[model samples]
Target chain A: MLVHAGNSRGAMRGERLCPAEVKRGLLDGNPWQADPSLANLSGVADALAGNGPAHRIIIDATASGEVADYHAHWLEQGIHVVTACKLGSGTTLERWRAINDAVARGNARYGDSATVGAGLPLLRNIRDLQAGGDTIHSIAGVLSGSLAWLFNHYDGQQPFSQLVLQAKDAGYTEPDPREDLSGDDVRRKILILARAAGVPLASDEVAVDSLLELAADGASADAGLEALDAPMAERFEAASAAGAQLGFIARLQDGRARVGLERLDATHPLAGGAGTDNRVAIWSDRYCDQPLVIQGPGAGAGVTAAGLLDDALRIARSTPD
Target chain B: MLVHAGNSRGAMRGERLCPAEVKRGLLDGNPWQADPSLANLSGVADALAGNGPAHRIIIDATASGEVADYHAHWLEQGIHVVTACKLGSGTTLERWRAINDAVARGNARYGDSATVGAGLPLLRNIRDLQAGGDTIHSIAGVLSGSLAWLFNHYDGQQPFSQLVLQAKDAGYTEPDPREDLSGDDVRRKILILARAAGVPLASDEVAVDSLLELAADGASADAGLEALDAPMAERFEAASAAGAQLGFIARLQDGRARVGLERLDATHPLAGGAGTDNRVAIWSDRYCDQPLVIQGPGAGAGVTAAGLLDDALRIARSTPD
Candidate 1:
């Protein structure tokens, strides 16, 4: 069932009913085929013919929200759809409503296992604690690994070059590391965490100060890390000597959410942090007393690959689809 | 539909499953249905037969392993069971298989949301981040607020009793903080985090070292605290000059987990972490250039309560029924 489709794109088109195709798909274990295609939503709808061997359809979208729009066509097929949208889970309550309606209409299960996109598994953790009626006093941690690394080199004016290079050397930066340096990366992550924490929020609500100096020219994703590096090294050196390390943090309290982007001096608790680690802690209520905390590494190939493997195993062990 | 039966143990068994009773249960929206009025598991099963009305179920066990046996029955139904008997999420792959099977066969979802008991949400965050292939590189943190608190107070030949009391006053210890000081609580939480990060582990595999000193009789959960109070004061009085602090750290790496119970001196980054504050960090491979770090207030009702509320809201917003 493992089809080597040659790496360009692995997609799940909406139940574009092609019994023969489905047979091939299921046989190929191209589970993505059961999902709606990104292009031409109507085309995918028209293709779905009838119930095929695929009962579960998981849409692993570039942005988890993409698959959310196809609840209608998916419901009639009775094929459950699980998504890992990058946006906050609540952003599309309207779409989720469609899902709830689809469930009511005898469709399939709809879940967003990947809404927050990697690192600390915030949503899942909150759900587990809630089952026990545990009180949560606060949730605090480093939400962005990229920003932390970017700031690590900021000695007020190291030109941010040496830092970016160091981050690159350390593998903290991505092939395109700017995304990691930009405040956007951690901001979205913490938003996902906050949403799971049950904090009603919009991404804008969390303040973000970029870890990398912005390019005046304003290049897009295509610019990659080039724009990020060429600038800022000159301005970041001063902060590094006094022993200030960069770390991005997200915090939640009574009806409020805040992001902490600061320089941690040698005395600061986080100053000694090594690289690209993110932590989310919940001040838990209910057990004996004082809040309970959970902390850990926030990013990497091994962990993420294992996480997906866990999801795949979970799916395999679940419905047998 | 709110059933106004007498709130007694006997009433649980005698409870009728009439339309009125169903209405009451629906109106209350409680997730658990417990009492002695039923003949067998079928009675509990029958009570749960209503269609489409969303609800919450909380199963609180009196002791170890009691809840798991009962839950195996619930697993046959569509209930998404969360329990402590399975303990932390990282119990075993074999256990994970059973739970996953139940979730699949029951056409349900299963998560040990409260696996770490009072600790903050761990699995939820990992689950939510499953979409974009974000990875977890390393996990290390000060897991026990109470232990951290106790460590803060100890300077000399501090009996654990005085320190526990000091933690209690500082809002670091719970009503009974012995669970934390004993190391079991922190170990369980670390297991949960490890599993969420996709490690297949068991709590027994973790090496735990208790920081509690043996009292006149023994270091029990209750009496131990009383004996602990005296030396703690002197420890704090003595340490204040040296500018040191006590902290409890839980770490998971290379499939192994351990804890550090220490008195960090002045010059140590973790020194002087006041009150219930906790700091956690991770070293990730994705950001190979640097290790990521996260730190924050690791204890308190306000923070924990917020975490609980977050879990409740995530459930309300998603598929936690």
Candidate 2:
């Protein structure tokens, strides 16, 4: 019941812009408008023309590489930010020390419940895992539900092509399902996770030994996904018969980062998870003398929507300052 | 990587005082001695050699009801205190506000994190919920794990024949777990929730419906517990079968307060939680579309300990002002 606490202390929460005051603040030697990145801030500036201040701002750039400009402008303006730059080819939704550093350096506040750790239990685990004395040695996840379902029944006996086509029709895969099958998304998620565990590594830095076809690289975000209509089960029948199920594993050891495309049996935590649910195993030195396992819905538009809302709720509930 | 932002802030995070400091604080002006029910504090008093300006004494008597005496005794000795007796509750944790009030009242900054939102999730939520047109309807949660597990699983079905025994097995039920299960713990929790929601509420005014077996009126903590245990499960199981889960719910409705044991289904959002996980569900008038949920390890040796440490960390991380 603690989504957002009622504003018992409303006056202290967000800035109540008095147009006169904001204009004054703007002219009071804070030359933020000169920054090219803030050209979009014209909306905020125009809004401040009257006696007012902007309580918050949101920007979703169509591209990447804009984080530096955004952070610099805000830092100079002494602003609080909650931005979700892309996954950086690593983790999806997580806060490593880099975030904490940003919070400190800017003398600003941040709560990005959206970008990382939607409602699915990623960020909170990282934020509070130490409480359980749990350290994460490995994190194996079924991040893409479509992939999990496709690979589960495919077993390489069926042409992955037909199975992927079936998955597309079932709405299990994204409209462009390539992201779900290529293992790149999984690698990015692993990177986000490693950073959360205090492992200093980038998503691209992790060596990914993928099980997907190398020819799939020719596909774009939207177009190439239809390539899965070919025969696929015939490709993996023998491996499937060997009690091997395709599972993507992200592992960290002795400062080396790696992603494994392996066959996990039913005994594996990944294989044992019921349904298309996402299961994650965190191996750490600190967890109560064993590994910490967190499992839940890994996919579904509804679940992702809920996760976004969860982030919204988290943002809604935290003190902006 | 986020660790050494700077020593400028880290020094404040060291809430872990040496034994000498603890002894010194206890003896300085005998803060506890001034409280009516508190044991004498002379042992500490005798140990402190005359020190610098009389120490600032802060006594938190939210539970003990000793606020008035705490301030009076310390104030008379030219030692200062900021207490619930004089300043309001939020002022105790609102660092800037607390310091301002302490200086204004000519008292030492007196506070313990226990009384307020503890780790400020309440305050943070309050800040967030208010920002996005949100009003709280009800707050229901298992504020205490011991009481929740006791009520959920402890009755005759698994009765050990005693509340204390059950709680001890669960941790922190009290010298008498009966007090916890009897609705008082949830009542206090409701009061806090109400206060967080900005409702003017008092603990006694909370409308609590206790489910203990009325016929099994206590002769002793253990004896009455066995008599009380039998019917509890059918009540919970029936709720679960009907697509609901059990939770000790604290509700704030229209400025009045009350708490009850709830058999809430998935619609209630408090369902599906397994064990010892604490949740706050706020159905607000503001966010009319849906209720907001904030779930976490609410009460625990580890979670709360992390919370306390987070408080210490916040202090260490903030500017000294």
Give every candidate's TM-score on chain A: 0.64, 0.65
Report the CA-based lDDT of candidate 2 relative to the real structure: 0.48
Cα lDDT listed for each candidate: 0.52, 0.48
What's model 1's TM-score? 0.54
Worst 10 residues of 1 chain A by lDDT: A1-10
Please provide TM-scores, in order, for all candidate models, with all chains considered together: 0.54, 0.56
- Residues B128-237, candidate 1: write the lDDT tens digits: 34433456665766766666555645555655665566667666655666666678778767776777677767667888866565344575666666665664555456
Docking class of 1: incorrect
True contacts kept of 2: 0.00
| lDDT, candidate 1, A221-307, per-residue tens | 545345655544433344466555555666677756666555566544344443454545556555333334433344555545444
Candidate 1 chain B TM? 0.64
Count of backbone collisions within predicted model 1: 107
DockQ of each: 0.12, 0.05
